[model samples]
Target chain A: MDIIVTELTKSFAGHIVLDRFSAAFPEGEITCVMGPSGGGKTTFLHILMGLMSPDSGTIKGVPSRKSAVFQEDRLCESFSALTNVRMVLDKSFDCGEIQAHLDEIGLGKDRTKPVGEYSGGMKRRVALVRAVLADSRILFLDEPLKGLDDQTKGHVIDYLKKHFNERTVIMVTHDKEEVDAFDARLVTLG
Target chain B: MISTMFRKSRLEKAGAVFLALAIWQIGALLLDRSIILVTPVAVAQRLFTLLPESDFTHAIAFSFFRIVGGYFLALLVGSVLAVGAGHYHGLEMILWPYIHAIKSVPVASFIILCLIWLSSDSLSVFIAFLMVLPIVYTNMLQGIKSTDEKLLEMAEVFRMSRLRKLKYIHLPHLKPYLLSACSVSIGLSWKAGIAAEVIGIPDGSIGEKLYEAKVYLSSADLFAWTAVIVLISVVFEKLFLRGLKMFFDRLERS
Candidate 1:
């Protein structure tokens, strides 16, 4: 089901972030939100994911199951890269499946090393793999390719496009190259 | 180069200890009074000879178990209370008075009051427990409070299980706090346990021997028992902390 937002309003301490906002996030399609900083791109994603509530709005057709790659890597620092991915997954994902996902994401070289030792781009790839493998109907990725080099970014974008089939994937980014890479539908906010 | 640095530190420690001992021996000799301050030689001789004595062995065992038992008991209760309190401000406020009292009260006063309420046999255990509870609770509570809010947000978004949150998030945060708590509380537990025993004069306990030493004015006996207490405390602290470190290392290991 598509997510429909109508007249969504939110403010923090009398400063408005979103006012009379409306958008339709097409179901099973990749949509990218782009705007200047403080334009409520993240705020909108947070509202859709139930991390925040709109002061006055009606949102329709959001799925119950959800997953996300937050702005920060947010990987379990002390756990290995494989364990970081597997923690959100259940028994259906076997050990081989987890290893395969991390290996594909370019973390194969040192899956045994803890995520705390991983570089920023490496940690982001692990977070991406985790979101893709999760059983959520909707996947929210906030600035998923910020720290990565162009080569790594291209690889991660390809990985997301491949696994995100038939799933509602919403990404927030400022980079036009990232949006073009996914051929994603654009939603601009101010 | 690393080995040389390590050996240099070890040599410095030995040299410091030797100088202290030499000063103590010189002081003992200059005093020319055995009752005033027993010589290091006399204390060492007394310590080795007491090993074969059945009563001395029993005293060591008796105090050892009671003190260690109380330390473990405090660890269990304090950790549970701190975790609970960290989750709720009202619960922490409710518990504040009790923890404050435990911290402010003198060990001697607690021992004397507890002796009136409890039997001589259990006095040392209760004293040890009382001395350690607030410390472990304070350190663990600080640890829980200091947990990263961002990681928790990530966990909540992923809907991670409680067991996984504990194993991955909470335990790592608590490792250093728990280690410091054990280090601080273990020494206090032994000291308080012996003090209680000396006051209660429990049979076949270290405190009883110390009290007997005082009553008879046997400086050699007093010095010998004191050395034993120090030795046991150090050995147990090293072993327990090493085990704790190993436990955390395994948790983080892939």
Candidate 2:
């Protein structure tokens, strides 16, 4: 089912973050949300993910199972990249299957090292892979590729395109090329 | 470069210890009173003699088990209580006054008070537990409270299980705090535990030996027993911390 946001309103200390904002994210497609900084793009995503509640609004059709690549990589620092991804999966999943996906995203060589030792761009890709592989009906990406260089960014965008599957993906970003790369519908918020 | 620096530090430490020993030897010679302060050589001789005695082995075993047992008990109970209080603010509030009392009360008062309720034999165990409990509880609670909120939110969104959340998030964050707590508390437990034993004068305990040395005015025996306590404390701390670190390393790898 598609998620529908109706007149969503949120404020922090009387400053409005989201003011009667309405949007619809169709199921099984990528919808990129874009706006200037501090424009409540992240707040909107947080509300839809149930991390925050809108002051006055109604949202419908949000699935119970959801996953996210937060603004921060949020990877367990001491754990390896493979362990970080494996944590969200059930026992039935094999490590070999996870390693194959990590290989596709160029993290195969460093899967054994702790994520604490990873570079910022490498950490971001690990977080992205974790989100994609999690058992979820929807995936939220908040500045998922923020720290990547242009070269790595292109490669990761390809990986996302190949792996995102049919889940509803709602990403917040400032880059227009990323939007065009996915041919994703854009929603502006400010 | 790091290995070279480490070697230099080791040499400096050895030099410092030698200088201190020289000063001690000079002071002992000038005083020329074995009753007041014995020479290090005399104390070393006394320790070697005591090492062969069955009573010495028995005393060491008696004190070692009680003090170390108390420390392990505190570690287990403190971590469990801290995790419980971390999840429930009401529970924390309820436990506040008791933790406060334990922290504020003098060790001597607790020892005397516990003597009325507990046998002298188990006094060191209880005392050690009392000394270490608050340290572990407070540090673990601080670690739990200070866990990164962003990672928790990510876990929630991913529908992660409680066991997974603990393994991936809570345990890793708590490692440093737990290590620090253990280091500080281990030494404190031994000091307090031995003090309790001395007051109670439990049979077959290191504390009983110390008290006997005091009564008999054997400074060499006194110094020897003190050195034994220090050696045991240091060895225990090193072994426990190394084991804990290995556990964390294995956890991260697996």
Candidate 3:
């Protein structure tokens, strides 16, 4: 069954964000959630990711084993890229696979350096790499390429398209170009 | 940049010590009364002479280990209590009154109360433990409370293990707070511990020698013993803090 939201409502400080809004995210498909600023794009993503609860709503068919690239990098700043990626993996996990992905994302040369020293775009790719590498049935991306240049963005989009072919992906993005690149089913909200 | 800062701090510390000793020497010379104010040289001579006696080593070891042991015990128990209190508000509420009382009451009063139940030989350990516990506990709880909510939420969604959550998220948040607590509390514990020993007048302890110095009108012995306490306290603080710094350095570099 598809992940479904019915009459989801949320408010903060007497201001309503999502009010009786409803949507569906089909399983095993790339879905893009799009909205202008202050349109509850982040709020919706957070609620769907179970980072928060809707004030009043019912969400059905949300899967376990979820992975996400939060709006912030949320990477451990004191650790290397490989360690950050390896953190979510099992004890017998190999670093070679994560290393190759980091190389593909232009972070191979800097993979051993602490994330604290990484630029914003570099950190974003590390976060993306972490999400892609983690074992999860559903992946959530919140503007995962927000700080990247077009060339790097293209490189990362290619990576996402290559690795996440069958995994359920929900991307929160404002850029129509990005949604188009993913060939994603779109849901625009307020 | 870090190395330069370290060297600068060391130099500053040396300069401060020199200035303090110069002032002390000048005061002793002007007073010209050996019984009232012992010169720095006289104190140093007394220290060297005191060191050869077997009782000196016994006194140093007796008080040092018991006091430092109490600190280590408090560190362990305080961290456990802080983690518990951080997880349960009701437990924290129950502990809050006692913690506040411990913090507010004078160290002397606690020593006297403890003496009624404990032998003088063991008084320093209990007093030291009591002095260190609340500080470590309170700071650690603050550390836990101040951990980043977003990171914890990330951990939750990732289904991260408890060990990983502690290592990756909680440890980093607690490091500075715990280290600062160690710094602030180590000095306090030593002072309280020694004061307890003095009041209790434990045999084979530095406090006994101090009591002897006071009753004998020996200013040089008093200054020498007092200097010994300061030196021991400072040396222990530096060594323990250095170990912590090394651990953090390895953590950050790794």
| Top DockQ model | 2
What lDDT score goes with residue B211 in model 2? 98
lDDT value for model 1: 0.91
**Could you tell me which 10 consecutive residues in candidate 1 chain A have the lowest summed lDDT?**
A84-93
- The list of candidate 3 runs beyond 4 A from truth reads B1-9
Query: Using TM-score as the measure, which candidate wins?
Result: 2
Q: What is the TM-score of chain B alone in each candidate?
A: 0.97, 0.98, 0.95
Candidate 1 residue pairs in backbone clash: none
Between prediction 1 and prediction 2, the one with superior lDDT is: 2
lDDT string for model 1 (B61-97, tens) is: 9999999999899999999999999999999999999
lDDT of 3 by residue, A1-190 (tens): 5899999999999899998989999988999999878989889889988888999989998888889999998988888998888888877878788899999989999999999999999999999988998889899999988999989899899999999958888899989988899999999888
Q: Could you tell me the lDDT of residue B105 within candidate 2?
A: 99
Q: What's the i-RMS for candidate 3 in angstroms?
A: 1.6
lDDT of 3 by residue, B123-225 (tens): 9999999999999999999999888988898888788999988878888778999999999999998999989998999999888888899899999999999
Docking class of 3: medium
TM-score of each: 0.96, 0.97, 0.95
How far does residue B72 in candidate 3 sit from its true spot (Å)?
1.2
True contacts kept of each: 0.59, 0.94, 0.53
Q: Which residue pairs in candidate 2 collide? A: none
Model 1: how far is B252 from its true place, Å?
Answer: 1.1
Q: TM-score, chain A, per candidate?
A: 0.97, 0.98, 0.97
Of 1 and 2, the candidate ahead on DockQ is 2
